[model samples]
Target chain A: MEKAIRKFWPIFVLPTLGAFAIGFLWPFVWGVYLSFCRFTTVQNVSFVGLQNYANIWIDNTFTHAFFFTAAFTVVSVALINVFAFALALLLTRKLRGTNLFRTVFFMPNLIGGIVLGYIWKTLLDGVLALLDRPLLALDATAGFWGLIILMCWQQIGYMMVIYIAGLQNVPIDLIEAARVDGATDFQTLVRIKIPMVMSNITICLFLTLTNSFKLFDQNLSLTNGLPGKDSQMLALNIYDTFYARSGPQWKGIGQAKAVIFFIVVAAIALIQLRATRSKEVQQ
Target chain B: MKAKKVVSLLTASVLALSMLAGCSAQPAADSADGAAESAPAAQEESVAQESEVAQEEAPAADGAAGQVYYLNFKPEQDEDWQNVAALYTEQTGVPVTVVTAASGQYETQLMSEMAKSEAPTLFQVNGPVGLANWRDYCYDLSGTELYSHLTNESFCLKDGEEVPAIAYVIETYGIIYNKALLEKAGYTADDITSFDTLKAVADDIQARKDELGVKGAFTSAGMDASSDWRFKTHLANLPIYYEYKEDGIGSTEAIKGTYLDNYKQIYDLYITDSTCDPSELATKTANDATAEFVNGEAVFYQNGTWEYANIEALGDENLGMLPIYIGAEGEENQGLCTGSENYWCVNKNASEEDIQATLDFLTWMITSDEGRAAMSQEMGFVTPFDTFTDEFAASNPLLQDADAYIAAGKTPVDWCFSTMPSENWKNMVGSALTAYAAGTGSWDDVVTAFVDNWATEYQLSAAAAG
Candidate 1:
C-alpha cells in the first residue's frame, strides 16, 4: 500500500502544484518584476530601474501610514490575545450557558470587515452626536480608538475559539495533580496550562499580527484616512497611491511599496513564529 | 486495488480537464458573439448606411463595419445610453455594448477594460489631465464627420493637428434656488445679484427662520465624500477662475490664491446660515442636501443642471439658478460655471472597422430623431452638435436659466477644475475644508492645502508624466 501511494503521489501533487503556480506564484513573481517598470497596463511596460523605489518616500504619507499601522497592530494584537485568552479560560470552566455565550461571542466574526466598519461608524457617530463631541472622521484620535474597538470586537471570538481548543486538550491528570499538590490556581495556569497552550498562542499571535497589519476594508470604510489622511494605514495608503493618483509613475511606485510591504510583513511574521515555536512544550 | 487505481486516475484527469475548460470558456463565448454579429453585419452594412444621411467621407474599407463597445462614465444616464444603444443596434444590426462604470470608479474600470483583447471602442476623457493618461489610446477625429458637425471649435481637444476628443455635453452649475422659498423669505432671485446682497438675503432669512418656517437659508454644506465636491471643487473653481482672469492664463503650475479671501467669505456664508451645525456637516451626505431643497426646508442648494431630475419635485416655475458670486471684480456679470468634462474619444487600438462604426454611431446619435430625443429629453444633455436644433434642446428649467444668463451677456466661468493636478489634490483640500468647518483645524490649513499643495501636486504630476 505504501509503495502504491508513493508511486501515485505525482498525480495528487501535480494538481495542487499547478493551481498554486497559476493562481499565486506566477502573479507574485510577475508583480515583483513589474515593480521596477513603468506601465499603465501589464502588456505595456518599460523598465526604469530603482526610480520607483526612490519615489516612494517623496510623499510622507507612506511613512505616516507605516507608523500608524504598526502602532495599531501592537495595540490590537495585545488586547485581542489577552481578552481572548481570558474568555477562553472562563468559558472552559464548568459554567452554565457556556455554549450560548460562545455562539454569541463568535457571531461578530461572521460579519464582513466592510459591513462591520460601517455598522460601527453609524453606531459611534450616533453616540458622539448625543455627547456633542467631534465625529469619527473629524477626530483622528477617535478614529484610531474606534478602529481598535472594532478590531477587538471582530477578532476576540476567533482567537478565543482557538484558545478554548488548546485548553481542552491540556492533560487533565496534570492539572489535577497540580491542584492535589496544593498548587494555587494562578500558579497552575502560569506554569502548566500556559506552557501546554504555547502552540495555540503562537498561532493566535501570528494571525492577529498579520491581520492588523494588513487591514484595509475596515480602515477604508471607517475613516478613509480622513482628517487629511492622518488616520490612513499602510494598505489604504498603497491603494491610494496606485488608484487615487494618476500617472504611470504612480503605479510603479505603488508596486514598489507593495513589494516593501510584503518584505516587512514576511519578516515580522517569521520572527514571531520562530520566537513562539521555541517556547512551545513538547506535549 | 486495480479498481481503486482506475478511479484515482480518472478523477485526476477529470480535474485537469475541468481547469482547462474553465480557462478556455471566456474567449470562446466572446468569439461566438462576434461570429453571430459579423454575419448580420455583412448583410445589413449597406442598409444601415442608406437609412442615415449620405456620408461625404469614403466608406469603410471592404464595407466591414464593426461592432461598438462604449464604456459610459455617467451612472445616472446608464439606462438612457442602453436604450439608445439598443435602438441603434436594432436599426443598424450593429451590436453595441454599453458598460457604465459606477460613480467614482470610472478611471479604475477604464484601466482594466483597456487591457482586455476586446477593448472599448468608444470611451470618455474628463478633460486635458484625463486625456494625458490615455492619450495614446485616443483615435484622431480630425477627419471624421463628427468633427465637422461640432458647433464650437473650442469643444475639441487637440493633439497638435489631430482632434483626439470632442466635448459631447455642455453643463451649467451654480446655486439652484427654490423660487417659491426665496419669495416666501421676502426675497427674489433678482434681489441677490452679487455676494453682498446674497449674504444679506441669506442672513435675513436665517434670522427669520421661525417666521419663514424654513430650516435655514442654505442646505447643509455636507463634507461627506458624496457632497464635498460642491465646495472643494466647484466652489474652489471660483478662486481659480478669478485668479486665471487676473493672470491672463488658462492654467497654472502654482496658483497664487488671490481670491481665497472671497472663497472663505462665500464658504463661511454657506456653513453659518445652513440647515445643520457646521461640525455635523462632516457626516451629512449629498442626498441630505437634495432632500432639504426638495422638501422646501432650504431656499438654496448649490448643484448643477444634471440635478434637474432629482429636484424636479419642486415645480418648474419655482426652480431658478443664480451664478455662484464670490465677490471677484465684475462679479455681478459672472455667469454660471459653464463647460464640460464629458469628452468622447474613440480608442485608437480598436480595429479600424470598429472606429468607423463608433464614428457613425456618434453621428447618428446627434442627427437621427430617436437618438436626438434620447440625448435631449431622456438624458437632459445639451449636446455640442450643430445637428441638435432648438427643437431638440433640453427643456430642463435650470438649463433654461443658464441660457438666460448666456443671453444676458454674462461671461461664463470655464471649468478650470479640469486642470486640477490629481484626485489626491482634491482630497487633501477636501480634508482641510472639512477640518476647518468642523473647527478641528484653522483656515490657514485650508489656504496651505489650496496654494502650496497645488504647486507640489502639479510638480509631482509633471515629473511623473516624464
Candidate 2:
C-alpha cells in the first residue's frame, strides 16, 4: 500500500501544491516585493530600495501601535491560558451539567469578531454609563480592558476544549499510582498532569498568542483608535496607513510596516513554538 | 497499447485547448483599447456641433459603444444612483453599473476598485486635496462638453492646466433650526443671526428647560464618526473661513491658529446647551443627534442641505438654515456655508468608450427633463448646471433658501474644509473634540490636534506627494 501510494505521489500532491502556489505562495512573494516598492496597484511598481522601511522607524503612530499590540498580546495570552486551563480542569471533573456548561462557554467563539465587538460595545457602554465613567472611545484605559475582556470571552472556550482533551489523555494508571503514593491534588496536578499536558499547553499558547497579535476586526469595530488614536493596535494601524492616510507614498510605507509586522510576528511565534514544544513529553 | 494511445490523444487535445484559451484573452483587452481611442474623437465632434442640444441627440451618435462603471461615494444617494443607472441602461442599451461604498469607506473602495482590470470609468474626488491623490488617473475635461455645462468655472478643480474634476452638486450646511420650536421659545430667525443673540436665545431655552417642550437648544454633539464630522469639518470651517478672509489668502501650506478661539466658543456652546450630558457624548452617534431633531426634541441640528429629505419627513415646515455664528464681527452678513465637496472625475486610464459613456450619462442626467427631475426631485440635489429649470429649483425648500441667500448677496463661506490635509487629520481632531467634551482632555489638546497636527499632516502629505 505504501509503495503504491508513493508511485502515485505526483498526482496526489500536485493539486494541493498548485493551489498553495497560486493562492498563498505567489501573493505572499508579490506582497514582500511590493514592500520595497511604490505603486497604487500591484501592476505599476517602482523599486525605491529601503526608503519605505526606513520611514516606518520614524512613524510615531506605527511605534505607538506596536507597543499597544505588544501589551495587549501579553495580557490576553496570559489571562486566556490561565482561565481556559482552570475551566478545563473544572469541567473534566465528575460534575453535573458539564456538557451544557462546555457548550455555553464555547458559544462566544462561534460569534464573528465584528459582531462580538459591537455586542460588547453596547453592553459595556450601558454598564459604563451607569457608572458615569467616560465612554470607551474617550478613555484609553477602558478601551484596553474592554478589548481584553472581549478577547478572553471569545478565545478562552476554544483553548479550554483543547486543554480538556489533554486532561482526558492523562493515564489513569499513573494518576492512581500517584494517589497510591500519597500525592495531594495540588502535588499530582503539578508533578504529573501538567507535565503530561505540555503539548496541549503549547498549542493553546500558540493559538492565543498569534490570534492576539493579528487582531484587527474586533479592534476596528470596538474603539477605532478613538481619543486621538490612543487605542489603535498594530493591524489597525497598518490598515489605516494603507487606506486611511492619503498620498502615493503612504501605500509603500504601509507595505513596509506590514512586512515588518509579518517578520516580528513570525519570529516571536517560532520562538514560542520552539520553547514550548521542547517541554512536551515524548508520549 | 490501445488505452495508452487514447490517453496520449486526450492529453494532446487538452493541451491545445488550454493554449487556445490563453491566446483568446488578449484580443478582448486590445479591442477595449481601440474602442477607448475612437470614443473621444466621436464625442468631440458631436460636442463641437451642438452644445445645448447635445443631451437628446448625443446618445444616438455614441450608441453605447462601451460600458460605464461608476464608483459612487454617497451611500444615501446609492438607491437613486442605481435607479438612474438602470434607467440609462434601459433607454440607451448602454450597460451602466453603480457601486456605492458604505459610508466613510469611499476612498478605500475607490482605491481598490481603481486597481481592477476593468476599472471604474467614473469616480469622485471631494476637492483639490482628494484630487491630488487621484490626479494621475483623472481625464482632462478642459475641452469636454461637460466643462461647457458648468454655470461657474471656479466650481471645477484644475490641476495646473488640466480640468480634472467638476462639482456636480452644491450643498450648504449650518444651524438647521426648527422654526415652530424656536417661535415657541420666543425667538425669531432674524434675532438669532449673530452669536450674541444666538447665545441669548440658547441660554434662555436652557434656563427655562422644563417650560419648553423641547429638550435643549441643540442636539447631542455626538463625538462618534457620524456626528464628529459636523464639528471637526463644518464647525472648524468657520474659524478657517474667517482667518482666510482676514489674511486675504485662498489657501495656505500651513494654517496659522487665527480663529481657533472662536471655534472653541461655538463648540463649548454646543456641548453646554445640549440635551444629553456632555460626559456621555463619546458613545453617542450621529443617529442620536438626528433623532433628537427629527423627533422635535432639539431645535437646532448642525447638518447640511443633503439632510433636507430626512428632516422634511418630520413635517419640518418653517425650518431654515442660519449661518454658524461664532461671535465674529460681520458674521451677520455671512450666509450658510454654501459650496460643494462632491465632484465628478472621469478615469483617464479607462477605455475611451467607457469614458464617453460616462460623460454622456452625466450630460443627460444634468440636461434632460427626466434626468433633471431625478436629480432635483429624488436626490434633493442643487446641481451646478444652468440647465436646471426654475421648477426644479423650487422643489427643494432648503435649496430655495440657499438660492435666496445667494441672491441676497450674503457671502457664502467657501468649503475650505475640503482642503484639509488628510482624513486622518480630521479624525484626530474629532477624537480630541470627543475627549474635550467628555472632560478627559483639555482645550489645549484640541488646539494641538487642530493647528500643530494640521501642519504635521500637511508636511507629511506634501513630502509623500513630492
Query: Which numbered prediction scores highest in TM-score against the true structure?
Result: 1
Pairs with steric clashes in candidate 2 = B36-B352
| Model 1 Cα lDDT, one tens digit per residue, B1-466 | 8897787778777786677677665531332221122333232233223322222122333444697888788878877887787777777767677766656766776776787787889999998878877888899999988899998887889989999999999999999999988888778888988999999999999999989989999999999999999999999999999999999998898999999999999999999999999999989999999999999999999999999999999999999999999888899899999999999999999998898899999988988999999999999999889999989999999999999999999999999998887888899899999889989889999999999999998888667545
Most lDDT-accurate candidate: 1
TM-score of each: 0.93, 0.91
Candidate DockQ values, in order, are 0.50, 0.39
DockQ, Cα level, model 2: 0.39
Over B22-101, each residue of candidate 2 has an lDDT whose tens digit, in order, gives 54554223222212223332332232223212222334424558778777777677668767766776688777766665
Instruction: For residues A4-91, write the lDDT of model 1, one tens digit per residue.
Output: 7775765777677768887789989989998999887766788998888888887798999999999999999999999999999999
**In candidate 2, what are the lDDT values of residues A47-158, reduced to their tens digit?**
9888788777554898899899999999999999999999999999999999999999999999988888989998998889899888898888899999999999999999
